[model samples]
Target chain A: MKKIVVSLLLSLSLLGLGNAWAVDSLNISLAPEQANPPSPQMGDWLKFHSVIENSGSQAAHGVVAWISLVQVDPGHEQPVDLEDWSAHKAVTQAILQPGQQVKVEWPMRLIQAGAYRVVISAVDRETGHVMTSPFVDFQVRRKPVVDSGRILPVALGVPMLVLGMMAWRRYRRRTGV
Target chain B: MNPITLIARKEAGELLMSGRGLAWLLALSVIMSVLSLLLVSNTELSLLDNAQVVYMVMGTVTALGALLAVVLGSDAVAGERERGSLMPLLLAPVTPSQIVFGKMGGQVAGWVVMYLLSLPYVWAVGSSGQNLTQAVAYLALFGTPVVLGFGFLGIALSARLRSVRSALLTSLITLMLLASPLLLGPSLRQSAIGKLFDAVNPFSAAVNSFDSVVIDSQPLAMQINRLAISLVWLVLTAVFAIRSVRKMEI
Candidate 1:
C-alpha cells in the first residue's frame, strides 16, 4: 500500500509539470513597425509586427494569433472591436515546429482619437494553452478629416440649382421668354 | 441624326425633363444629402473608418441608381402604350432592337445624373481614406452594369406585361429578393446555400467588390470573378429585353 501511494503521487507531479511546460513553451513579442509614425493622427495607417517563438521540445499545433485593442483613456476605458479596423483579424498556423519562430504583420487604420494599448494573443489548440505578448502603447491625436460645412453647400446647392432650372424652363415655355 | 440617336434623345428628354423624373431626382438628392450630413456630423458615425464610410456611400448610391433605373425602365413601353404613344414609336423607322437600345440609353442617362449627384457625397465621406480613387472607379465600373441590368429586367417585364403597374411591382419584388442577401450577417452568409446564392448574385458582387476595394484594400485583379458575374447579369438581361420587345404585339 505504501509503495502504490508513492507511485501515484509521483505520476501526478509529472503530469502537472508537463502541463506547465506546455503552457510556457510559446513566447510572443509585439511591437509597432519602425516605419510607423511615432505620433499617429486619426485616419493614419499603422502597421504592427508580432513574433511567436516556440522554445520547448514539442511542437505547437493549430495555433491561432489575434490582436486586441484596449482604449486606456482616463475617463473611458473599453475594449475596441477591430471589425472596422481590420478585415483579417485572426491568423492561424497549422503547426509550429520546436524552436521555430513565425512573424505576423497587421495593418490597421486609426479611426478615432484615443490612447490605446494593443496586444497579440495566441492559443495552442492541442495543448489548450494561451500566451499573450506585452502591450504596445500608442496615441492617436484628434484630426478632423471631414468638414461637414464644405459638404453642406454641394449637397444642398445641386438639388436647388436643378429645381430652379426646371422652374425657369417652365416659365419660359409658358410666357415665350 | 440616326434613328437610334433620335429615339434615345427623345426618351431621355421625356424622362429627365418631366415632372415625375424631376421628383425622383429631387428625392434622391435629398436622401443622399441627409445621409451624408448624418455620417459626417454624428459623433459616433464620424468615428467610423473612412473606407467604411466610402463603402456605405457607394452602396447607397448604387441602390438608388438601380431604383431609378427600374422605375424608368418599367415605364419604357408599358407607360407609352398606356398613353397610346407606343404605336407611333413602333411605326417609326426603328427595329425592335433599336427601340430597346434607345430606351436603355435613357436609363443610362438617368444613371449618369445619379452618379454625378453622388460624387460630392462620396468625396465628402471618403476623401481622407485609402482607396478613394478605387472606390470611385469601382462604383462606376460595377454600378453601371448592375444598374443597367436592373433597367433591362424592368424593360423586359414592361414589354411582356399589359400594364406598367404590374411590371413595376414585379421589378421591385425582384430587386428586393436580390438585395435580401446583403442584409444577412457574415455568419449566415457563410452557410452553404447563402454562399451559393451570393456567388451568382450581381448585387452581392457589386457590394462585395466595393467592400474588398475600399475596406480590405484588395487590388483590382482580385475583382475579376465578381465583375464577371455582374457582366453576365447585364448580358442576360439585355438579351431578354430585346427578345421581349421583339415579340410584343401592337
Candidate 2:
C-alpha cells in the first residue's frame, strides 16, 4: 500500500513538471549571430532581426514577438513610450511547429543620441508561454547641428521684422496712437 | 476687365504692398530656410529622411497658407465695413456673389504665391530624396483645397460678424482648434478622437495625404478617401461663405 502511494505521487509530480516544460519551450534570439554594432549614429536605421523557435513537442499558435526599448542614456529619453515605439509595426506568426524557426525584423529609426538596448519577447497567446531575448546594447552619438540652417530663419525673419516695424511705425504716425 | 479678375488683382496688389504681405513673405522665407538648414546640417541619414523633409515642408506650407487665408479673409467684409470701404464695392454694379468669388480668387492667389516662395526649399530638401517631383505635385494638388477651405471659412466668419476684432479672433481661434492635433502626444494622436480629427480637419487631411504619398509611399487609391474628405470640407465651406455673402447688407 505504501509503495503504491509513493508511486502515485511520483507520477503526478512528473506530469506537472512536463506541463511546465511544455509551456516554456519558445526560444527568441537576436540576428547577425555575431558581434553586434557597438555604436550606431543618431538618426540611423538599425534592423533588429530576431529568430523564434519552438522547441516543445506540441505546436504553438498565435505567437507574438514584442520589441521594446529597455533602457536609454541617463539624460536622453524617448519622445514616446514603449507602445508608440512598437506601434509602427507588429510581429506575429500564426503557427510554429516543434523544431520550427521563424525570422522577423524590427526596423528602428534612432532619433535621439544615447545608449540603448532593445528587449524582444515571444509570447504564446494560447498557452501563455513567454520567451525573452537578451538586451542588445548600442550607443548613438550626436551629429553637429548645422549653423547654416539659421540663415534661412534670419534672412526670412529680418526682412519680415523690418517690414513689420515699418508698417507699425507708419500706422502709428497715421493714427497718432 | 472681368469684375472677378479686377477684384482678385486689386486684392493681390494691396496685400503685396501692405505690411501684412511683407510679414507673410518674411515668415515663409524664414520657416523654409530654417527647415532646409536643419536638414543640411544633420549628417545622419535617419536624422532627416527625404520623406520627413518633404513632410515638414508640405505641412509647414499648408499650415502657413491656411493662416494667411484666415489673416486676410477674416477682415474681408468686417474690416472693409469697419473702414467704410465695403460701401463702394457694395454700390458697384458687381453682384455680392461676384465679390465673394473675387475674394476667393485672391485667397487662392495668395496661397499660390506662398507655394511659389516655398519652391526653393522644397526643391533643395525634396531633391535630396528620390521623389521631388512627386512631392511638388502632391503639394500643389492637395494644397489648393486646404487654402480654399480655410479661406472660405474666414470669409464666412468675417461676413457674418460686424466687428473685425471678433472676426479675426474667431478665425484665429478656429485655426488653433484645427491645428491642436499637432500638439497631441503620439499615443493620443493615434486614438479614436485623433483619427476622427485628422479625417475631419482639412488641414490635417492635407498633411496626412502628404504623409501617405511621401512617407508611406501609398498609391492614390489609398489616399482617395483623405482627398475626398478634404474636397468635401472645401465645398461645404465655400457654399457657406457664398450664402453669408449673399445675405449680408451693405
Tens digits of per-residue lDDT, candidate 2, A1-177, equal 999999999999998887676556787888633333456665456777888889888888888888877446676555334432343455888899999998887877655556777778778756645678877777777653233454455446545654676687679769999
Error of 1 at A31 (Å): 3.7
In TM-score terms, candidate 1 sits at: 0.85
lDDT of 1 by residue, A49-131 (tens): 99998977899888899999999999879999887777668888999999899989989888789999999999887666578
**Model 2: what TM-score?**
0.67
Segments of candidate 1 deviating more than 4 angstroms? A1-28, A49-66, A83-106, A121-131, B46-49, B182-192
> Which residue ranges in model 2 land beyond 4 Å of their true spot?
A1-24, A27-29, A33-44, A68-90, A93-95, A114-119, A125-129, A132-177, B23-64, B78-97, B115-143, B157-170, B182-199, B204-223, B246-248
TM-score for each predicted model, relative to the true structure: 0.85, 0.67
On a 0 to 1 DockQ scale, where is model 1?
Answer: 0.40
| lDDT by residue (tens digit), candidate 1, B73-190 | 8999999999998999898888888999889888888889899889888887777656789988999999999999999999999999968999999999999888774566457788
